[model samples]
Target: MTDFSGAAFYGLVARLDELIATRPGGADGFSPSARVRTHQNGGYRSAFRGRGMEFDEVRAYQPGDDIRTIDWRVTARTGRTHTKLFQEERERPVLILLDARTFMRFGTRDTFKSVLAAKAAAVLTWVSMEGGDRVGGAVVMPSGIVSHRPQRSRGRILGFVKAMAEATQNGFGAPPPRLEPTLAEAIGRLRQGSRPGTLVFLVSDFHDFDAAAARELNRLSLQCQVTNVFVFDALEAATPRGGHYPVSDGEAISSLNADSAAVRAAYAQRFAARRDAVEALSRQRGMAFIPLQTGDDPAILLHPERMQRTRSGVRGAA
Candidate 1:
C-alpha cells in the first residue's frame, strides 16, 4: 500500500509514483473528446494548418523548393545551393500548465486543490505518453515557475514530477504576483517552448482568472489545442450546513458562520457564479473544460464512461 501519510495537503511526493504506476492501465479510460487531436500521425487531425516538420535531408535545390529552407553552410562549402527536405513529424507535444499558488492550497474535502491538480496533470501526462506524444509541463507556484520542455523521454517526465513536488512543498510563503501578469508569463513560456500542434492543459482553481487571462488563453488556443481543467473543492460549491468554519491562508485565519441561512445561500451563489463564468469563457474560446472536485477519485472522474455520462446528463438538464 502507498503511504500517503507523509504528503502535505498539496505535496506531490507520495501521490506521483502511484499515479505513474497506474499508467499501465492506459489513459484510454478518459473521454475521447478530452483527448487532444494533434497534427501528428496517430490520432485525430486538427482543422488548423501548419503541422511541424522534421528535417529529412539536404538535397540539391529543387526549382519549386522554398528558398527559406536553403542550407547556407552546405551551399558555401560545396558551391552548390542545397534545400532542406522535411517531413511532417509523427508525434505532437503535450504541455501541462499547473497552478500551485496560495489559493489552490486550501481544501476542506479529501485533498487540497493543488494536489488534485497534480493528480490530474499526472494522469494526463501519462496518457499523453501512452499515445506516443512528447510530454512536458510548467508548475506555477507562488515561489516561481518551474517548467520542462516537452520530450518523449521517461526521464523528462520524472523530472517534471519532481519539480511539482518541490514546488508544492515550498508552499506559499509570500503573496504571489498578480494573476494576470503571472498568467502572461506562464503563457509566454508556453509559447516559447511549444509548437503549433501542441496540446496544452491549463490546470488551476482559476481564482485569478480575468479578462487578461482570458485573452492569453484565446491567444494560446489559436496556436494549440487548449484544455482548461478546473479543479475545485466540493466545499467551495456547498459549505457544510449549520456550522462555523475556520479558514487560513498561511498568513491569517478567518471564520465563516455557515449557520446563517443567508450566508450559506450567498456563499453557494458566489461559487455558482464563478463556475458559470469559467464555462462561459470556455465556450467563447472553443476550449474544452473539465471540472474536477477534490473529494472525487481522480481515476473515476477521468473515466471515459463517467465523463460521457456526466456530460450527457448535463446536456439533458439544459
Candidate 2:
C-alpha cells in the first residue's frame, strides 16, 4: 500500500493507455498475450429480447415472414414496405479476483506485493471500462470484506480504485489486525459468484492454500477466461543475510533463522521450492500466469517489451 496518492493513480492511468495502445494482438513474437478462446463461448445474457432486428435487420418478404409480422399488409396501406427493427447483445463482463492476503506484505524493494496487486487491478479495471466492458472485482483480504459489483462506466472503475487504495492502506498497517479472511475460501466464493465466460483475473501470491484451494482455481479456469497474476516479493526470492529476521502478521511475531551454512542453504532451497510449486500449478492448469515483482515496473509488466525498441531485444524475449 504505497502512499497511492492522486499523482501515482494518474501516472498509472497514463501508463495503462500506453500499454494498451502498443500491445500487439494475436500469436506473434513479443506481443502482450491476451488470452484467446477458440473452443468456448461464454458471456452474459440480455434482460429482454426486444422486438425487431436490433443488430442485423432483414427486409420484409412479400409473403413470407409469418403473415402476423407482415407490415400490416403494407399493400393495403401506401404500397411502401418495411418492418420494425431491434438490436443484438454484445456486452461482456470482466470479473477480477484480487488476493490481498497477509503474505502479500513481504517485500524488499520500492513497494509491497499488495501495492503491486492493487496497481494491476487498477490498470485492468480502467482498461476494461474504457473498452465499454463491465468491470468488477473483490479485494480478498482479511476475508472478503470488500467487493464491487460489475459495472459499465468510468465512475465505477474510479470507485473500485478508491476502495482498493483504502484497503491497501488498511492492510499495510497490520496483516489482519481485526477479523481477516483466508485466500482459499475467498477465491471459491468469487468463483461461485462469477458467471460463465467472464474474463476473470485471479491476482495473488497463491501461498500455502493447500490442494483444495488449487482445485477451486482449476474449476474457475474451466468455466471462465481465467488469468492468473502471481504477485511476488523480492525478499521471497532470497534473503539478505544468513541470519534470522523477526516477522509478524500484526497478530503474532516469529523468527525465521538459520545458524550453520548448511542450514541456511537448506532454508533458501525450501523457500525457492515453495515458489516453484506455485508456478507449477499455473503451468499445469494452462492459465496465463504473469509474475509481478515488487521492484519491477508496472508498465513493463503490462506491456512487456514495448519499452524495448531494438530488434535483437524483441528477438530475445523473457
Best model number under TM-score: 1
* Residue 16 CA displacement from its true place in model 2, Å: 15
Model 1 CA lDDT for position 85: 69
Residue-wise lDDT of candidate 2 within 101-220, one digit each (tens)?
666765666666776777777667655654556778787765455778888766776777677656555544443655557666777777877886677787788776577777887888
Q: What's the C-alpha lDDT at position 21 in model 1?
A: 55
Off by over 4 Å in 2: 1-90, 171-175, 241-244, 248-259, 304-318
| Poorest stretch of ten by lDDT in candidate 1 | 309-318
Question: Best lDDT goes to which candidate?
Answer: 1
lDDT of 1 by residue, 241-292 (tens): 7788887755689999989989988888887777677777778877777777
Q: Which residue pairs clash in candidate 1? A: none
The 0-to-1 C-alpha lDDT of every candidate, in the order given, reads 0.67, 0.59
Q: Per-candidate TM vs. native?
A: 0.72, 0.65
